[model samples]
Target: MRSGTAPPVPSAPARRLLLTAAEWAVLVAEWPGALPPGLSVEVPGSRQRNDAVAALVARGVLRAPVGGPVEPVPAVAADLAVLRRPLLTVRLETGGRGGRRHGWFALGADVVVVVLTLPDGGIELSLAPAAGLGAELARVVPEAAAVTGPTARGGAPPTGALPLGLLDAAPAGRGGPPPTAAEAALAGELLRRTAGSLDCLVLGRAGGPVGAGQVSWLATDGGWVGLRPHPGGSPRRVVDVVSVRPADLGTWVAPTVAALLEGRA
Candidate 1:
């Protein structure tokens, strides 16, 4: 081959191997730590681990560190942006007393709970109250609380009644079928309690096909917590009053509920 002339193109599998090597370089640069256990790049063909490691060495992205497994040069801002896209954005609002002020970002259906920590060491929790949809809300979140009117003579307002309005309004540009009967009832209760304060509340049913026996619940600060049980559960029950702050409400409420009801947060 002439000097500077490129070799014939490699086979498709070979080309894929090259690409995998390139991706490994990128991953190393983004994560300087050793490949966390169980982390490995997929490759074409049945290649041994040594072969993969050798290919990465040729790419110059991976280098054996004195005391570390492998390290990449510090990533630039542009690279950092690319890496950040997959990350979940969590926003926390703090400012309550006695470790009671906290919020959370909960994933709908997934049941992933991202608890929000406040500056005052307060942790937000949602619970069902006696005033509104008592145990109903508690069944879903087990922490949601109903909020009646203002507090009694000397007591403060309910724990979860922030001034942000009940659920944030649905966003625009969203087109989907209406909620199921159970979801509709849940949304209705939320709306009834927060109507004056909020524009609307989103109620999202489980994405899968709606079945006949899905259950639902509602909670308000000081109000009752109502539980409309599924087929096997006992009759609906209204539980005693619990306390909840507005900040803690969303943490317990499912994001699907927010997304389905109001298109936006």
Candidate 2:
């Protein structure tokens, strides 16, 4: 990796990348904006560096959705029909090895969501709002979904959305008790900090043994934030936060978390 280097976005498992200032320059030098799906642009670099670039292409194509920030949900199979927005919903007439994966990347102020069904016998639902995410999202988006967006100041290894199901997966009478007033205030602050240009938010488990508490993600105008709910379900514990970027919206969260660890957040 040198002054000019841009990694490819993986396709098999949907992934997004936040290009470095230098990397962005390299990417724009060749191809600017989203390339056609399955298309690859040669990033400028040495053979070794270029090999890394090809590896990225093999893995996938990284770019923002042409449309805008959008969310994904099971089209027909999903019971939450309300969450379904008007996106270029493509239903693959095939299935995979029971593969169910989903991800999102940022483009400008807009975010794009991707859903895949691997092996060949499932529906791959990818939804992105033509007008990008709207204020109405507050009606359906969980307060925790924003934390998982493109928050890492640098970028995380594009991972799956927070498995929100984990929140309900806890044993009966769980969720600790009700949240206290202070706890509620903290949660509110976290939300307030990252609510302006929010695109998507998913509440899932943190990296830990099973039964770990829930962590909600926010893709906001200022940036991204990852926080876990108080055991009592009040103010969320901040896990990470990252400023937004251009190449991919959701690739900045890792650095945000690092900042928190470094006592900078």
Candidate 3:
């Protein structure tokens, strides 16, 4: 299966950590059988670097399902547990997977369903109300219009956390400014450029093999989604890692996003 986006470099603060010698031995590429009695390794630098290392030991390169019905499969039990109540779940076909309903899973909840064709990857989440929500439907916020609003074209700009509704908007009606997690952090100018409903979630360093790979934007490059295998012993063992860069970025991304002028989504 395809792989997800990788994490970023950890902070550079010199430090020391103690690990068992056997663990250290795992670092040895030459497959040294074992460590001698009474031994340990003192590792210096950030432990964040070893996140991939630990994941490899826990679950090696995950392989894609070789042959399974392309038809829909149930979401994982763990995944289901996390998705409860008012918090509805919707899947989008970031890649060319699934049918028209492919991205929209049938969860049946009081939620606005959105099918976002993100950069390279797709995410199915909520954009419902967190208490008092906008009664309005989705609309494409034109570049000029976003600024013309009463907030004034040259205002302080949006800061702090955006409303839950604004971030997870449904891709219909007049879609709002579809901001990527990246855009939300950046000044509104970056967001003003795009006018589409596709967004990216900046999930720090992708926890490799921890769950499925995570999806992230790569600035100039498109987006990528991580996919890991469901557990099964080999013959069944798939490739350890797979990375699928979306065929094209910005194929999505257009006039849906509006430049925020402080205190707005």
Candidate 4:
């Protein structure tokens, strides 16, 4: 039941847009296409609507080339949609509450990938069946990586701050880099073996409630998988721990993740 704050205001030259509810609805619905003829006009009847669209265009959230159709910027559209309707909000600190929400989005109901925003203006993603997130979306931020941590058990208290090893050590932010072929292959196989129930585990202090307060685990009935982001790049390395007893997860998962993070595995 946590609420979200207002959309962030951009720095100078990108003023905050005061979009009417009708205008916002239309913009969200008609993205990637030209506005309806009526709303595109600047006549008195439509001046306000047209002005809102123009402001978005000026901010580069929408594009209108000399003769091209006005369209929503793909990356901006993705970001805006997530901001408006986040599936989950995670707080990296154990007792954290209220401010500085880290949003999470399940790309699509059937899609296994989840995207999370980092507080340092970076982004991280998780792939249940490791795969490619298109280059356009990947480049939305300067720093991006795939992260895996401890899953939130049904009733267990939250544990672990969002790990900072990758972010702390990552070099200056740059264009998001796509995952490596090897990383994708490993993820694919891990998901296939786990019957597509795999998810990257995140160990964070607190998170907003999801439906029924249920959270997924990194381990599935088939086995367990641990993934770590490559500290030096966007690609990730994974370890598969199969046929292990549930009671042994404690003994095996953490050590496996540690080795993966240290590049010893």
Clashes of each: 51, 43, 31, 3
Model 3: per-residue Cα lDDT over 67-185, one tens digit each: 84121123222222233221222232221111111222212223332222222332222233221111111221112222222322333323232323332345424345554574345
**Candidate 3 lDDT trough over 10 residues, lowest sum:** 254-263
Whole-model lDDT values for every prediction: 0.32, 0.31, 0.27, 0.34
lDDT of 2 at 112: 36
Over 1-265, each residue of candidate 4 has an lDDT whose tens digit, in order, gives 8688978864222112334443454454544233221122222236666776787688676788788877777755554554344332212111011112232322222222333334443334343311222221222212101121222222221222122222222553523454355544544444333321222222211233222221222332233333333244422222322233223323323333233323311
Residue ranges of candidate 3 with Cα displaced over 4 Å: 1-186, 199-210, 216-265
Candidate 2 lDDT over 1-265, as tens digits, reads 4776679754333222333323323333434344222222355467644554444344343332469531222331231132233112211111112122222222111233433322332222233432332321222232222333434333232222222222232543434355455544544444444432222222211233211111234444344343322334333321323322332322323333223323311
Residue 43 C-alpha lDDT in model 1: 41
Query: Candidate 1 at residue 193, lDDT?
Result: 47
List the candidate numbers ranked by TM-score, top first: 4, 1, 2, 3
- Per TM-score, the best of the predicted structures is 4
TM-score-wise, the better of 1 and 2 is 1
CA shift at 104, candidate 1, in angstroms? 4.6
Q: After superposition, how far is residue 148 of candidate 2 from its true place, in Å?
A: 14
What is the Cα root-mean-square deviation between model 3 and the actual structure? 24.2
Model 2 CA deviation exceeding 4 Å by range: 1-175, 196-216, 228-265
